[model samples]
Target: MIGREDWAATALAEIREMTTENFAAELESLEKRKRKKDIERRIIEGPKQPWRPTRHGPMREVILTVNKDWFSEDAAFFGDDQATRENEFGAHAVAWLKANFGDDVIHARADRDEAAYHIHAVIMPRATVEIAKPKAKVPTATATRRMLQPSIHPLIENYEAAQDSVGEWFGGLGLVRGERTAAAIREAREIGQTPPKRRYHAKTWKWRRQEELRLKADARALKDERLALDARVVKVQEREDEVETVFAVAEGVSSGAFVADGASGQPGLIEAPVAKETPPSSPTLDALRKRSPVGFARASGVFGRAWQRMFGQARVSAEAEAAAGVADAMQQVAEADELIAKASALLPQQTRTIIAKIRQTIPAIMRRLEQRVKPVLDDQKQDGKGPEKPRRE
Candidate 1:
C-alpha cells in the first residue's frame, strides 16, 4: 500500500521530467484543466479526518503498478499471442480508468523506468450522480437531473464490482482471478504437483520455550567467562605478592636481621635464610581447612608442583640454597585462592543481576534488527550476493 511516504507532491515534477513522448503529451494536455491547479491541495485535504484523531481521509488519486516480471513469460503458456499480449494489459488498464472516472480522470500515464511498469493517475474529486426532480402535481411523469459533486466513496464502496469487471475484461487475455488461482493449485495437487508452501510468522509456545532456554544459556556462558577472567587476575596478583616477599626476605638476610646458631661452640652467621614470620591466618582459610580438606589438599599440591619446577635444576651450590629460599613463596598463593573462592561464591548472584538488566533490552534489540537489518540481508541473499567475506582475525 502506498502511503504519504511513498507518494508526495514534490515528486510530481520529477515524474513529469522522466515521461516518454506519449506520457509527456498526456500530462501536458492534462495541465490545462482548471482542476489541475488544485490537484495537490485536493489530494492532501481529501485524506484527512478532523473528527478522528488517528484516522486518515480517503485518497484523492491512486497509482497501479503492474508486475513487470509477468511480461517476461512465454505468452503461449497462457494461450495468447506472444507479441501483443503484454501491450494489451496496459491498454486494458487505461480503458478501465476512462470508463470508470470519465472526465474526472484528469491524467494517466505509463512509466517504464522503474522495476515494474506502472500507471500513474491523477483524479479530481468529482462524481456524477442522478437526483429525482420534485414530483409533478399528478405524478404523471418524474424527471431527474445529473449532478456533479466531490465524491470518491461510491467507487471505494463498489470496489469488488469494479475488480470483477476488470478481471472479466482481462480474462480474454487469460489472466486469472484469485478463485481461479486457487482452483489451479487444487488441480495441480490432483496431478501430484505440490504448490510451494506458504511461510507463516507467529510466536508459538515451543518457540518461546526455546528462546527462553537460549537466553539462559547465554547468561550462564557470560558468567563463566567473567569468573575465568577473575581467576586470571587473582593468579597475577599472587605472583606479584610472591616477588615482593622474595625481595623482603633477601633484604633481611643482607641486613643481618636473620641469623642462625653456629654448629661449633661459637656465635656464627647462618647462610640458609628461613622465614621469620609464620603464615597469617584468615577466617576464609580456617573455613576451608575445617570444611574442604580435599580442596585445601589440591591447592597445596598445585603449590608444591610450582615449587618443584623452580628448584628442578638446582645444584649443591649457592644456587641450590638460593632455590630453597623461594620455596615458601607459593604458600601465599594457596591462602589467596581460599580467599578468592569465598569471593567467587558471591559472583553467581551478581551475574544474575547483570543478566536481568540485559534481558530487559533484548526485545528492543530484536525489533531493531528485524526492521533495519533483516530486510537488507534478505535482499542481498535473494540477489545472490551472499554474506560479506569474513575478515581474518
Candidate 2:
C-alpha cells in the first residue's frame, strides 16, 4: 500500500504540472501584447528612427521560459486561498533568487492566466559568471537629490510619450525591485560549500547500532509476554479437566442403592427410583451387606423379622449379593464427590493465578510496543539528516 509520504509527493507533482501549464499560457498572452504594441508604435512614429521598446516590454520578453517545482504547502505561512498561496510562493522564490544572485535578478512576476499559477523571472546575465560587480556606495544626500531632478532633454519627453501610448496590458506584468546587501549575498554563496563526508558516515553507523538494540529489546519483551499468557492458559485448562473428571465419577456413583432406618429383623433398604412416578423397591440384604458388612451383621440380630415383611421370600444370600453391587456404586459416588470438591476448591486459585499472570505480562507487552516503534522514529530522524533532493520538472 502507498504511504502518507508517497501520497503527498504525488499531490505535489500534480500541482507543479498545473502551475507550468498556466504559466506557459500567460507568457504567450504577454508576448502577443508586446508584439501588438511594438507594431502600433512603429506605424505612428513612421520608419527611419531607431525605435526603443518600452522597459516593461524588453523585461517581460526576456522571460523566455519558466522552470517550476512544487514547494511546501504550509497553510500557516501561505494563507488559505489558492491565489494567496500562489502569490506567497512566487514572492518567496523571487526573494531567494535575488538573495543568491544579487543585481543579476532583473525581473520577477507571477502569471495568473493559465490553469496552473506560477511566477516568471528574468536574469540579466543568464549565466553565473556574467553578473556585474556592485557599484561603489554614494552619499545618501547626493542620491536623494538626483532622484528629485526633473527631465530636461527632448528624448526624455519622447520616452515618457511612448510609455503613455501603450495600454495597461503591456506594463502590468513588470518586475518589482528588492533590497539586497553585500553580506547577505556572500553568505548565500558560502552555502554552496561541501561539508566533510566522514561526519555523515559516523552518524549513519551510530543510528544503525541504536536501531539494532531497539529491535532486540522488542523481540525479548514479546517473547516474555507470550510465555506468560501460555502459562495462564495451561493452568486454567488443568483446573477444568480436574473438575470434569470428578463430576463424571459422581454421576456413576449416584445410580445405586443404600440401607435406611426403621426396621425390626431386617433393616429397610432404599433403591434407585426406576421412574419419576413409580415407588422404589426395597434394596436386597446382600446389597446392603456388601456396603456395610458390620452394620448389616448388627442389624440382622434385631431386624430379621422386618426383612421378611418388607421383601417376602427374598433370600438373605441373594440380598447380600445385591448389597455388594450397591456398595461398589456408593463408593464410586463418594470418590467422585470428593474429587469434585477438591477441584472446585482449587478453581478460584487457578483463575486468580491466570489473572495475575496476565497482569504481570502487561508491562512487558507495553515495553515491546515501545521497542517496536522506536526504530521507526530513529529511521525518520536519520532521514531528516540526509541532504534534501532538489525538486525537478
Candidate 3:
C-alpha cells in the first residue's frame, strides 16, 4: 500500500468533473478519434474491469512506480532535503518514461505525503502506435505499403532494460543501487531490529539482501584481519632489521675492518662497547686453530652454521608472518568494490601500496635468503666434519 494509489477514483473523478464543467473543446478533440464500438455494452455491463476477460484488456494502462528506499533513512536516498530530492527524482523518472514510451506515457507524478518517497506513472500500454507518417519502403518492395498501419512496439519487451535504466538514474543522485538498500534492510532485521517495509513482494530480493549483508560483514572482518597482519609484518620487518644490524656489527668486529667515518671519523678497528669474556672453543676446533687455513675454515664453519641456524629460524618466522598478511590481502581482492574501497581507506595510501608490493615480493626475498645461506651449509658438509652442533653463544 506504500506506493499504491486510487487510480480508478482519480481517473473517473477527473474525467467526470471535466465533462460536468462543459469542456466542449476537449470533447470535440476526443471525438476526432474513433468512438468505442460497444458504448451501450460498456454502460450496461459497468465498464470492463482489469480482472475480467476482454479483447482489449491487454491494452489497458500500466501503473509503474519509481522511487528510493524510504525506511532506512539512508542519506543517499532521503538526502538533506526530502522535497528537493523527490522533485529531482520525479523529473528524471518522467523524462526517462517519456524517452522510452514516448506519447504512450500519459501521466507521471510524485507523491510526498507518505512514509516513503515514490512516483506513480500511468502508461498507456497500446503498443501498436500510429505514426504521423509512414517510413520509406525499401526499393525491393513490389507493392505500396499502407501509411496508416500502426507499428508494433511492445512495452514489456524492454522491462529489464527499463529496470537497469532506473537504477542508473538513481545512482546519479548518490543512492546505491536497489540491492544495497535491500541489504541494509536485511542487516537491520538480522540484528533483531525491525526494518522498513519492502517495496517489492518477491522473496528472492530478501534473500539477495541477506547474502549481500553477509558479504559486507565478511569484507569488514577480512579488513580487520589484514590490518592486524600488516602490524605483524611491520614488527617482523623491524626485528629482521635489528638482526641485520647485529650481524653487521659482528662482521666488522671479527674481520677487524674499518668502521664508517660517521662513527669514529677515521678508518680503524672499533672496540666493542663492552668487552665480554670469549667462550671456550671446542677442543677439536681449538686444536685446529694452529692448523692450516683449511683447518681454520672448518672451525669458523661451525660458528657460521650456528649463526645460520639462528637467523634462518628468524627468516622462516618473518616469511610466515608475511605470508599470512598476503593471504588476508588476497581474500580482500575477491570482495565487492564498495567493501574493498572501505577496507583500503583504513590504511594510509603509501602503506597500502607497500603492502601490495610486499605481497608480490616476499617469496623472492625468501628464495634469495635461502640461496645466500645454502653455500655455507654446503661448505660445512663438504669439509667432512660430521655435523657437530655449534655451541650456543
User: Evaluated with lDDT, which candidate comes out highest?
Assistant: 1
lDDT of 1: 0.45
Evaluated against the true structure, the overall lDDT of model 2 is 0.39
Candidate 1's error at 38, in angstroms? 28
Off by over 4 Å in 2: 1-204, 256-339, 345-393
lDDT of 1 by residue, 15-96 (tens): 3332332233333333434347555554454422211131333234545544566666645455564555446666877787
Cα lDDT listed for each candidate: 0.45, 0.39, 0.43
**Which ten-residue region of model 2 has the weakest summed lDDT?**
141-150
Candidate No. with top TM-score: 1
lDDT of 3 by residue, 1-393 (tens): 222356556555644543333333223323333334433343455422222244543333333343435434445655675646556666666776677667655556565544466665665443222212313353321221111111233444444455566677667766544454566687898999988776664343475788789999999999999999999988655444333233233233233231112243222223334434323331222333333333234223322333334344333434443344334433322222223234334465775574354334334323443454456445545665334455799
For model 3, what is the C-alpha lDDT against the true structure? 0.43
Which segments of candidate 1 are over 4 A away from where they belong?
A: 1-69, 72-88, 109-120, 125-157, 179-319, 325-393
Global fold similarity of model 1 (TM-score): 0.27
